[model samples]
Target chain A: MELVEKYLYAIGKKLPRKQKRDIVEELRSLIIDNLEDRVKEGEPTDEDISQILIEMGSPAEVAKKYCTGTQWLIGPQLYDMYLMMCKIVLGALLLGYSVSIVVSLFSSLSGSGFGQIMWYIAKNLLSIIPGILAAIGAVTLIFAIIERTSKKPLDIDFAEGGKWNPSKLEPIPKKEEVVKPIESILGIVFTVFVLVLFYFYRDKIGFYYMSSLGDNWVMVKIFSQSALRTYLPLWTISWVLSLGMYIWLLCIGKYNMLARVFEMIVSALNIGILFFMANGPHLFEFDKLGADFIDLQPAVDFLTNNQSTIFYILAVLSIFGLLANLGKLIVGKVKGRI
Target chain B: MGNNQHTTDGLIQELRRGTLVLSVLSQLKRPQYGYSLVQCLAQKGLNIEQSTLYPLLRRLEKQELLKSDWELTGTRPRRYYQLNENGKEMLQELSDEWNRLAEVVKKLTQEEEIK
Candidate 1:
């Protein structure tokens, strides 16, 4: 009787809350019925009861038949995607954090030693961990809900897609038109690198002209903080367009007329934005640059006085570069070279 | 186990699983409690695990093929199951299908034997 009660309790624990009481009662009665029948001829000992329960099977195995729902937080269906998301997010976080920490530390290397720099980076990485964990938790929760609701596995391939039609497959990319995955991936990395660069290390950018401050020659940037702010919006749109084009190339894996035209449009927009920023208020901010050092006086005077001329030179160069690429792409399309 | 023995066991297990419902329905014309049905089927040489039978019985009842009620039989309460109208119809259709399948299997095996 003691053994039977314990066995019932074990199985009862595994039962779902909604149907627990009734299921437990039914299971208990079955056990008692089987037990009473076993010793009907004579009163049995505890050994007999235990032996009978043993033949019936373990509590977990018996309960498993009644409880078919999986208990895992993320089931097998969504595990691959969960793993992949974590890899991508954590990889980017680590890469960007390390780069920024190094740049920020290197800029202000006056009082801090190597150990201090290392400690600062280590502390910052630890501080950002909660944000990373929050991101991971959100991804896991979304996937877990999907795993429960989604009936089919999430690995349906392009050719084996649920609604795939043979006619939907495009023609094989021509040799010249083939968008190499390595090239497209490099483009995406470059765009992402620039995003990280401007977001964290914007001050580190621009011409770091070596100028004498007393006996020491320190690097001074020609573009002031205000000048960088003027370029921010232009840089943002260019970054977005570049990233978008990279994704489009990755998905299509070829140079179609649509992609070529999109690239051309983005290049035109960037060129226009560059010229507009060059002609904006306080382009070089020579009045401000004059205070940096006496040694940079000549360079600053020439830059400030000839600011429009220098900007026009830059604007014309970028225009020529973009126009040449556009011409090459058009010629390639016409000749089926790309 | 030998590959031939493994194949036979798998085939027999599948065959038993497919026909388990039909066998249970045929015996459920009269109301029977869980253990009683287990013994009744055992006597007819269709032994099933007690654990498997209980859930299968509940599922069939939930599906409306079987109707169950709790009755105080002797000292303890027992859940007795009886076939519903749906169960009776299902049993007849399954019985016909079983006959057809058995005949096909017999003819196929006989041809294999000759080969």
Candidate 2:
């Protein structure tokens, strides 16, 4: 009798809450009926109860049979997308972290000792674990909510019965029309890495070297504080917008009119920022390197002399890139590929 | 040899899974408590475990194919299940489909044996 109660309790605890009591009671009655038929003469012994429970299988197994609805946080319909998103996020984080670590090491090499460099590398590597974990959690949480809230077959349109149209199913996109996830993932990683570099290590963007074997290492920051401060906001905005657009394209998984328009706007912003910076200020701080650095002074002087010309070249390159992107968009539109 | 026996058991289980629902539904035309239904099916040489049958009964009731009530006035309380209108219609349709499927399978297998 005690064993039966224990078995019933084990099964009951695992059953879905709404139907738990009824299921438990029904199972109890079934067990009792089986007992009455078998142990006709007297109170059922432990042996009889054990046999009945054993035949019914384990408590967890029985409970699972009665669990009617979905028991997954992310159901099958969304599971593939969830897995892909996880892979993308993890890949992006790893690439971005490695790039940042290498850039940081290069920027700091002139000033820091070998031991310090090793410590920095260790710290950067350790930091990646938490970032990876948090990103995974965020992706999982988003998919879980979608699984619970959305209709089954998660990609189903919201349009009611007759509102849908066969014409709305666009033709199979050409290779170029499809937004390759890897491209967007790379774009996302690059934008995030650049943004982090400029925001946190703005002064470290420079030249670093030792003039001679016994000489102390020296570094000269390329950009003046005022110049960097002036451009930081624009850089931040452009990169943030690019990051958002890349993520959106990744989710949509195709190139279309809306994406084309957004890409053009971001390109225009880049052109404007580069052109303005090209004409704006004495962009590099040449005095910081000075004439005293024996081996590197000539190189520093040459860079100082040609800083404006360099900026102008960069601006022209950017303009060309923007034109190329615009031309592709036009071609895609004419071909009905967008 | 053990692996072969295991494979055979799995295939047999897969074959039985669909028909188990039809078997339970066929027996539910008359009201029967969980134990009695189990016993009746067992007597007919259709052995279903108590755990399987009880949950299946609840599921059928949930689907509105069967209706049930607790008979507390009996010596001991027991929930009795019988087919509702929907269940009768379902059973008829399923029976027709099963007969056709059985005929097709029988013909194909017989032809294979002849060859």
| Strongest candidate by DockQ | 2
Clash pairs, candidate 2, are none
Task: Compose the digit string of candidate 2's lDDT tens values, residues A1-338.
Answer: 88988999999999888889988988999899899889989788899999989998899989988988678998877787788888877877777677767767665554578899899989888988987899899989988887878764545463557476666566676787798888888887777677766776676667665555634555667778898898889878889999989988887788877888898898788878877777777677754654456667777778777877877788788778878988887886787653
TM-score of chain A of 2: 0.75
- Give chain B TM-scores in order: 0.91, 0.94
Q: Each model's TM-score, in the order given?
A: 0.65, 0.79
lDDT of 1 by residue, A72-134 (tens): 888876676578656554655566667766555545543476798788877888877985798
Residue B35's lDDT in candidate 1: 86
Local accuracy by lDDT, each model: 0.76, 0.83
Q: Which runs in model 1 stand beyond 4 Å of their true positions?
A: A1-6, A41-59, A69-79, A98-125, A141-338, B4-12
lDDT tens digits by residue: candidate 1, B1-115: 4579888999999988998999999999999998899889999999998888888898888789999989998987988999999999988999999999999999999999999
Q: Which pairs of residues clash in candidate 1, taking residues 3 or more apart in a chain or in different chains?
A: none
TM-score of chain B of 2: 0.94
